[model samples]
Target: MLERQSTVGSAPIGSFVALGDSFTEGLGDEAPDGALLGWADRLADLLARRSPVPFRYANLAVRGRLIDEILEEQVPQVAELTPDLVSFCAGGNDILRLGSSVDRIAERFEEAVVELSSHAKTVLVFTGFDPRGTPVLRRLRGKIATYTAHIHAIADRHGCLVVDLWSMKALQHPRAWSDDRLHLSSEGHRQVALRAAGVLGLRPTRSAPATHALQGRVRQPQRLDDLRWAKEHFLPWLGQHLLGRASDEVLEPKRPQLLPL
Candidate 1:
């Protein structure tokens, strides 16, 4: 967790803008303020409680958003906000749409970051959890990992923060998923919120129950013996230790092209 000390009266006061897709929109069996209870609202609530001044939140998340769409419309909106803090959650749709090279995703993300950094002091970017273990939507883990790495490298180059959400408890076990399997359940969302709170230096508030009953019935438990070992071991370790911190190695020479893989 990042250490944040309140400097008497120095907490910057400004609006917070969240730009992303369904995760940001909180699409599931939950609702807050007549809308899906997404992470951005959760983050904003946490920040308001922790900071010295109250800040407003602006959510610009639309469901089914791809990287190209984000770059086209959302990026410019975020750039215009000039917010004190900005949270970006993208790339899942990219993996879904174009399972191409990592370099390609990196280029798109880098452009988004360049525009974001020019306006905000701190930007929080999310790398999604491993999706290979899912029963229905399995087999895309490699592509997702490639896209995640691209985003990570871009965040590294720009000195932004990342939340390695891909490494949490859900990927290994069958119980972590909601009925839909793609989106997180209310509890799943809460767990994610807790981890995100740890990253953002804020506290999480319990989400309200959905106005409508949650769809998708949970499936019977199946053993995860067929899943890859790296899904169980390496990804979680990276998320806990490396994702949000600066590189530890001392360098005689500094070059972005030679960055660690």
Candidate 2:
């Protein structure tokens, strides 16, 4: 875990904005209303509880966004909000690309962080988690580690607080992940929200139900199950890359404006 900076003390936050791709957008953390209620939302709820005054929040994230796309589309909007705090988690999609350059992605990501940091009182960044149990994603663990290192370096240089997802052992469990094996399940998002609250020096007012109780025994995936996932998710992802397309090509930001929560 990165040390909490003195810049953002254990005080109540006024406003917050979240920026990134699917993870930040809360892809696998679906609600009964068919809406995404990701970690960002849960974190915002925690912030709201900690604050005595009105708390405003916004989430400017979309699925399948690359580092550059986040820089180009979300940064300006988030900068305009000038929230008390901002959490950024991007570049995972970029790292998954075949010929993506880790160095370039880091450079662009740092630029976005720098820009957002100037506007917000504090900026929070995240390191990607190791997808060890997932079949195909496990193979890209090396690349994920490399990108996570770059993220740490960038956060250090900019004096940003980091939520070190890479070091979280709880996420290594298969139950923490969704069927897609890429995004976190609702329980996983809740755990992340609790950790984020801890980083911000706040105790969660409410606790999320334990994942073990909600998710029963998780058996090792069968060979056929792996093949089915490859056909359904991996192959389509590859096709999108080959065609220079993204899943969120026609999608809009989940929360475009800062509003009271």
Candidate 3:
């Protein structure tokens, strides 16, 4: 498929806007000030180092957002913000639900990419994480794959860069996940940032730590860990599901405005 003419080389990616749920918001990876410093932020750092111009970044992602919420709240802002680049990854939350339709979610996703493609100089989209790493989430792998296919088709149609998370083998390790088993660990995020940079046709500088995934394969896990994860993490998440509550329903965005890095 023909890639849209990217501003990656012709011009600097001075501005980036991130939209999605907790993953894009940098959950599981906390900073000293108690804010998320996820892959998007790390990608911004990588971009800033490469570009001659100053970079601005905004993350409008909250923890429990579905694709519809992202469409209503985030997609409309793309034109107004007019970012040089926009990273969008949503619908994972919807995929996790009991009776969710992947087709319906894909339609919403396509709508978002269409809007994003219209306004941003460069638009990047992500596939769902490979669930094999976390035993608890592994049951939904088939659904995730179906949704991931839709994501790829949407990216192809819109000429957006695609980050195929499901194909990242390093993520299949236990260490790559957080205690919650849902979000990526700090090490995992680092690896993902490197992958994102590679997709944008950029290389990591010597100063930046190399992705662990690049070196080799990681070790396997113990069966006992699964039981412990179920007790400590999965049960609470199940409770939240039963109660119809969101992780960050009332919490304002950590980074609402596009500020210089």
Candidate 4:
């Protein structure tokens, strides 16, 4: 059994298990406890706000995790947690380390999802940025369409939800990412959390009181058709307008024509 550390005891009985890598570990920003507040943490914070039941989250992610490694190490421990909502954000390291092959990576990913479905109510699979927008993070988004397609199919087969971060990312400008060209900033985290809430059918706001809160936030809600546009077009344009060229200076390509060009 994988021993639980950093257990949020104040959290409700309900549990969420995150199985993935550094992104899941929140590698960039620091948390109150001195850990990085990755997307999972932000999502957890957002979900806690809207959860009707008390929520306990177990972030079972380590740095530099690969697909095969995750299958061997993380899968077994999932059965023990028996989470209500399961999130899996992997494949970055695998793609980075093992070389990008659509078939090989998808095979391992499919197997992981198949195993994970049996142990949870809904498995939310998280992925990285969209390649179309971020030219620098080629490793992160290479063969992304093919990869996400397989993931979409796998989620469909198992009745799980694939949170398409890639698609979300395509809609976003390059500036949303941090200096490392990988992880999200605080605003980026909030944007992702809001989208996650939309996916789970919860409101984007903080934890609210029971009565005044809206019901059926997720259950039978309309799917957000243009989340990519919302992120890419709306957010960036807004960012440009509000923050001025500074936002463009931060997010937009700084040196489009450089070097030997």
> Which clashing pairs does model 3 show?
none
Residue 214 error, candidate 4, Å: 27
Q: Over the full model, what C-alpha lDDT does candidate 3 score relative to the true structure? A: 0.82
lDDT of 1 by residue, 1-261 (tens): 223531113546345777877777776637765546655666566566555655667777766666777788687876566777777887676565433555676688888888999987778788867776564345777777777777778888998778887776443444445545666666666556656666655532443233112223534445563243346643443353335333454322011111111
Give the best candidate by lDDT.
2
lDDT of 1: 0.62
Predicted candidate 4 versus true structure: per-residue lDDT over 1-261, tens digit per residue: 111221223433256777776666666667677756766777776555545566677777766566877888787778876877778877775554434587788888888888888987778886556755443334445477677778888778877766777766322643445644456665566566556656665543454223122222322212352355455554553354334324313221111111110
Looking at model 3, which ten-residue stretch has the lowest summed lDDT? 1-10
Model 3 lDDT, residue 185, Cα? 81
lDDT of each: 0.62, 0.83, 0.82, 0.60
The TM-score that candidate 4 achieves is: 0.68
Q: What TM-score quantifies how close candidate 2 is to the native fold?
A: 0.89
Per-model tally of clashing residue pairs: 2, 0, 0, 7
For residue 44, model 4's alpha carbon misses the true position, in angstroms, by: 1.5
- Which pairs of residues collide in candidate 2? none
- Alpha-carbon RMSD, each predicted model: 13.8, 3.7, 3.9, 14.4
Write candidate 2's Cα lDDT for 1-261 as tens digits. Answer: 222321257555889999999899998999999999999999887777667668899999988788888888999987579899899999888888888888888889899988998998889999988877678878889888998999999989999989999987668777787887778988789888878877777653454457345345556788999999999887887778535765555888888899998
